[model samples]
Target: MSDIHKHIEESQVTLSELMLPSHANFGGKIHGGYILSLMDQIAFACSSKHSKYYCVTASVDTVNFLNPIEVGELVTLKASINYVGKTSMIVGIRVEAENIHTGVKKHCNSSYFTMVAKDDNGNGMEVPGLILDSKIEIRRFLKSASRLASKKHSKFQETNFEVEKYISELKNHNVIVDYKGYK
Candidate 1:
């Protein structure tokens, strides 16, 4: 078996693009679907880069949209691999938005994606696990993992439905939320 990594070793992926009119909602904000679309793509990118294998989103935990973004801005998605299980990977995603005209950027959302590695046969495959090495990264990974573990799927869905629905509505309404500066 390959050694696990607690932190991303190869590299991290940052995806950024301009806010097209099609990506905006009735409120002139970026659509939630657009953000989630990018997040899923970036998550796949990070997973593919690391394992060179096919990966799929098993669950997206705590996708929090604390604010909104406007049109004519740049949406940036940054993803990093934090931890890995036998055939599962825990990814951390942070979505940011920048006003292309003014260069204002905000941290609008954060999410945890669990992916299952698969081979060409579509069966679950083994992947190198993530080994925690540093203190800070370890803390963050542990915190995320704990939240993921402790939060039951049903409860997570019910309690976080507001946030989830907001994201869904963002998709349906094509809402735009700008980023808030990361603390």
Candidate 2:
């Protein structure tokens, strides 16, 4: 709602850390939760920088882990504001893992997090608009807007869903209907 606008680069954040054995899972690969925690931290930093206020995570969109990170690999996470509403921003994060020996990097995960700026009293505060300058920035903003619309539509469908109408369809799947009252 603020008249002030800022560029995407103004608030971008990147974090890199070497993956340790303690951060690995029993399978020897880095734990997904640890990476997620890192992503959240970067998202928070990026959004807070942009808004100039304390920000809290509202939601996180699809997180797809494409590659497994190994112990001793260097993991890098990049976060930027892709879109902004009156008081909320969608932060896009990209995670990559690099081999220390070969210097080869692979895309590990991509996620979108919705963050809301908050005031000292814990109420939502208005955030500055984005000044998208490049085609890529505009594309990212449009995609985030589309994704938000799709999420709203999905929620609407869920709210209006009728279990009785779809109950019989469950039989076609792997689930078993054991209740006697639904006959």
Candidate 3:
């Protein structure tokens, strides 16, 4: 943690654009990749603004496309720093699409992007601590922290996992095991 502290509102960013025909996929809806690109850009901007250093995306959490966007719809991405670590920040991004004619909006996606601040040498750098002034901010920070802890736990389990110990359990699943070596 750095000596400096900043509020979450200081680093909030919102980007809106009209979906173009070229951004559509074979099914005639806006492409998921294009929306993901926009989300990445907004996450970078929000994290950089809070950290005051160049940032790189470390990982993106669950991104489920809940709704499809049409070519004429207006897409909006809102990003904010939800949690800050010594050198990394978790950015919460919400994506929505609005029909221009109907003035109706639908949530397209929600994702959490982990970004790390970098120095000129491309090494990780410390970021300012977050000043949680509201219950929502506190909840967001705690949620991000919990998610990080869960991810670490999952990784640890994977590393020490014994396939042979659970091989018999595979019979309960949809998978078909045909290896002759397995008794």
Candidate 4:
């Protein structure tokens, strides 16, 4: 294994950018898409560092816009590889915006991105395992990791006939399946 492949055991990518006038929307607030682009880049950096190959976003489970980031604040993007599959890895991202003048910080968004590692041919490729180190990081990772696993299971259930039948039966038994947009 190459030295660059050690990204799984412990890795963190941070991006600091001053609030730019170009990044703001008409209301003078930074757009979610702008933040999302930074998040995506951070996630991909971490993933590529781990796999030492190119990766692409397979899915973004949910993106919550917790708060509006005003202009003139510092936006920081953090991303880490939390879980790995045969050919996919789940990255946990937390976006925080800080007012440097006031020292006030608030979480702007939180999201999980799944990346599919591929060879030059675009076929699925395996990735190494991930190791959790810190207590706080471990706790946060557990929450996101659980969601990642559940997301995969739900996707599988949708594609498999037996799982769909079971879900239907569970629904008949009054189990509520949360409805979400597929696209």
lDDT of 3 by residue, 1-183 (tens): 689999999999999999999999999999999999999999999999999999999999999999999999999999999999999999999999999999999999999999999999999999999999999999999999999998888733866976677787778899988766646
TM-scores for the candidates: 0.77, 0.91, 0.93, 0.76
User: What tens digits encode model 4's per-residue C-alpha lDDT throughout 77-164?
Assistant: 8888877777777888899999999999999898889898889999887887655557765676577678866866784564464543
Q: Which ten residues in a row have the lowest lDDT in candidate 3?
A: 155-164
Query: Which residue runs does candidate 1 get wrong by more than 4 Å?
Result: 4-7, 152-183
Cα lDDT tens digits for candidate 2, 23-115: 999899999999999999999999999999999999999999999999999999999999999999999999999999999999999999999
lDDT of 1 by residue, 1-183 (tens): 566443475746899888888988888888898889889999998887766789999989888897797777788898888777777777889988888877878999999888888999998877776655678678877887787677655543664554533444456575576634322
Higher-lDDT candidate of 2 and 4:
2
**Who wins the TM-score comparison?**
3
- Candidate 4 lDDT (Cα, 0 to 1): 0.79
Candidate 4 Cα deviation (angstroms), residue 167: 13
* TM-score attained by model 2: 0.91
Q: How does each model score on lDDT?
A: 0.79, 0.95, 0.95, 0.79
